[model samples]
Target: MSQAITFKNRVWENAGLLLFPDNFDEKKTYPAIISIHPIGSCKEQTSSNVYGKALAAAGFVVLAIDAAFQGESGGEPRFIEDPYERVEDIRCAVDYLVTLPYVEENRIGILGICGGGAYALNAAMTERRLKAVVSITGVNFGRLLRDGFAGGTPVESLEAVAKQRTAEARGAALFVNNMLPASVEDGKKAGIEDIDVLEATDYYKTPRGRQPNGATSVLFSRLSTGLGWDAFHLAEVLLTQPILVVVGDKPGGFGAYRDGFEIVRRAKSEKKELLAVKGQSHYDLYDKPEAVSQALEKAIPFFREHL
Candidate 1:
C-alpha cells in the first residue's frame, strides 16, 4: 500500500507518497529507496510514481517526493530549480527515512530520472548513508541548459542568458524560458523540429503524460545559477557508493547521457554500470511498459546486491 506523507523541514517541508510492500510488516525493517522526478517535474509524474511502486512491489519501501519549492513542497520564490537545493532535498529525505522504524537506515538507496538523476549523483557524492544510486536518462541540467541539448541551441545564446540575469537582478521580472511555441504552427515557424524536444513536448503538454503542476517553462535565473553546477562535481573521489546509469540505445534519444555517460564513468565506485535500453528513447522509459521492465531487470538486482 502507498500512503501520502510529509516530512517536516530538514531542508524543506516536503510532501510525498510512501509505498509499502504487500503483506508489509511494520515490526520488521525493510530496504528503502527514494524515487526522484525529472527537472520541472513532481512526485506525481510517471518517473517517480512508476519506479516507486515497482521498487515497493520488489520488496523495498519507496518514497517519491516533490523537490523543494516544487509541487507540494514549500519554498520561497516558487519554480526556481536549484541543483544544490535539490541535492539537499534528497539528503533531507534520507534524514526522514532514518526516523521511520520500518525503514532500514543503512539500506537506503536512490533512483533519479532525467535531471533528477544528476542531482541524485550529487547527493550520493557526499551522502554516504545512501548505499546505492540509479540514474535513468540522466542529464546534467546545468551543462544541457548552457550548451544546449545535443548542441541544438547556439552557444551565443548562453551569453544572452547571462545578460538577462543581470537585468533581473536590477529589478526586472524573472526571465523565463519559452519552452513551448505559441502553437504547432509557431513551432514550425521557429523551426523547433528537434525530435527530443518534440517527444518531451508530447509527453508534458498533451494527455500522454501531463500533470497540473508540470510546467515545461523554467526561470532563466535558475538556468544561470544551474550553469555553474557540475552534477559530477568532485565525483571521482567522493562517489564511492555503487551507481547504475540507464540510458536509451536510440541516438538522440537519451540526450546528454548518451555521450555524457563518461561523466558517470568518472565515479570511483568499483561497482558501477551503464545499461542502455535497446531501441528505446529517453522519454519512452518514462512509462512504456517494455522499456521500464527492461530497466527494472537490471535495477532490481543491482540494488539487491548493493543495498
Candidate 2:
C-alpha cells in the first residue's frame, strides 16, 4: 500500500508517495530507496507505479517524490525544471528519509528513471549518505538538450533564451512550454521521428501513463538554466559510491543510451556496472514488464550487495 506524505525543502513542501514492505516491522530498520520520477512526471506515475512498488515489495521502503514547482508539490514560478534545484530536491528527500527511525540511515539507495536519473547521479556525487545509486535509461538532461545527439545548439540560441529570461525578469509573463506533443500522430506531423519520443507520447499523452496531477507544461526559461549544465561533471573524481546504470541498446532519438555508457566510463567507483538490454528502446523500460523485470533483476542484487 502507498501513503501520501509531504516534507519541507527550503521554502516549499514536496509531496511524495511512500511505500513500505508488506511485512514491515517497526522493531527493525530496513534498507530504503528514493525512486525519483522522470521530467514532467509525478510520484503517481512510473516512479511509484513501476519501480517504487516493485522495490518496496522486494523488502525496501521506497519514497517516490514530486519535485518542487510541479506535480502536487509547492514552489513559485512553477515548472522551472532547474537542474540544480532538482539536485537539491534529491538531497532534501534524503533528509526526510533519515528522520525515520525505521529506516537504516547508512543503508539508503537512490533510483532515478529517465530525466530524474540524471539528478540522482548528480546528487550522489556529494551526498555520501546515499550509499548506492541506480540510473535507469538515464539521460544527462542538460547535455542532451544542449547537444541533441548530433551537434550542439549554437551560442546564438542561448543568447535568445537569455533575452527571453530578461523579458520575464522585467515582469513579462513566463514563457510556457509544452513538454510533449498532444499525441503520437502530432509528434510525427511535427517531424519527430525518434522511437523513444513517440513512445513517450504514447505513455504520457494516453491513459497508459497519464495521471490526474501530471502535466506536460514547463517554463521555457529552463533552456537558459540548463544551457551549460552537465549533470555528470566532476563525477570522475567525486562519484565514489556504488552505481548501476541500465540502458537499452536502442537509444532512439533521446540518446540516453550514450549518456549511460559515458557515466560508467567516467565514474571512479570500482563497483559500477552498466546493463545494456538488447533491442529495447528508452520508453520500453518505462512500463514494459519484460524490460522492467530485467532491470530489477540486476538492480535488487546490486542494492543488496552494496546497501
Candidate 3:
C-alpha cells in the first residue's frame, strides 16, 4: 500500500510517498530505504519510485521523497537548490522513518541518485542513523559548482556568484537555468565530457521521466538566501560510513565516479565499494530496467549486509 504523507522537520513540512510491503506485518519491524531523487527532480520523475517499488516488493519499506524547495516539500521560492538544506532533508527523512512502527530504526539506509547521491554522503557523515549509503551517478556538486569542469577553486567561483548575489540584492532577479535544455533541438551542444548532461536532458524533458513538477525554474530576487551554497567538505569524513558508489561506464559520469572513488579510497574508508556498469550512460540508469536492476541487485545485498 502507498499513500502520500506529510511530516515535520523543525519549521518545515516535507511531503513523500510511503510504500509499505504487501502483507506488511505491523507488529514486526522491517528494514527501510529512503530514496532521494536528483536535483531539479521530484520522487515521481525518476526511477527512485520504481526502485522503491522494487524494494518494497522485496519486503523492504521504502520512502521516496521530494527534497525541500522542490515538488510538494515545503519551502519558499520553489526550485531553488541549497546543498546544505538538502542534506538536512535527508536527515529529516531518517528521523521520520524511525518513528514508524514498521520500520527498524537501526536498519535504515539511503539511496541518492545523481545530485542526491552527494547529499546522501554529506548526511552520512553527521547522521549516524543511516546505516548504509548508495550514490548513483552522483556528482560532487561542491566540486563541480566551485571548480567547473576543467579546473578552478570554490573561492574563485564564489567571487562570480558573489557578484550575482550582490546584483540580486540590488533588485535584480536571480535567474534559474535548467540543467538540461528545454528541447533537444535547441539544447546546448555537448562538450566532450558533457554527454551525460545531454543524456540527462533526453530523459528529463521527455515523457519517460517528465512530471508536472519534474522540470522547473525559479526566480529569486532575494540575495541573502538565494545565492548561498557551500561545497560538501565532509565527503572525506563521510567515507567512514558504509557506502556504495555506482556509475555508468559512459564518458560523463564514469570519470566523476572514478575521481570520487579515489578520493574516498584515499580517505581509507573500509566499507566502500565502487561499481561501474559497462555500456551504460548516466541517464540509462534513471528508468532503464537492466541497468537499474543490476545496481539494485548489488545495492540491496550491500545494505542488507551493513544495515
Per-model TM against the reference = 0.91, 0.96, 0.88
For model 1, residues 24-129, the per-residue Cα lDDT tens digits are 9999999999999988888888755688888989999999998887888888667878888898888888989999999999999999998888888889988999
Tens digits of lDDT, candidate 2, 99-148: 99999999999999988998999999989999999999998878776765
**lDDT agreement with native, every candidate:** 0.81, 0.87, 0.73
Instruction: Please report the candidate that would top lDDT against the real structure.
Output: 2
The per-residue C-alpha lDDT of model 1 at residue 14 equals 87
Model 1 reaches what TM-score against the true structure? 0.91
C-alpha RMSD between model 3 and the true structure:
3.1
**Top TM-score hit:** 2
What lDDT does candidate 3 reach at residue 30?
Answer: 94
In candidate 2, position 50 carries an lDDT of 93
Stretches of candidate 2 off by over 4 Å are 148-154
**Which 10 successive residues of model 2 have the least lDDT summed?**
148-157
| Native RMSD of candidate 1 (Å) | 2.6
| 10 residues in a row with least lDDT, candidate 3 | 218-227
After superposition, which runs of candidate 3 have C-alpha atoms over 4 Å from their true positions?
149-157, 188-193, 216-238, 253-255
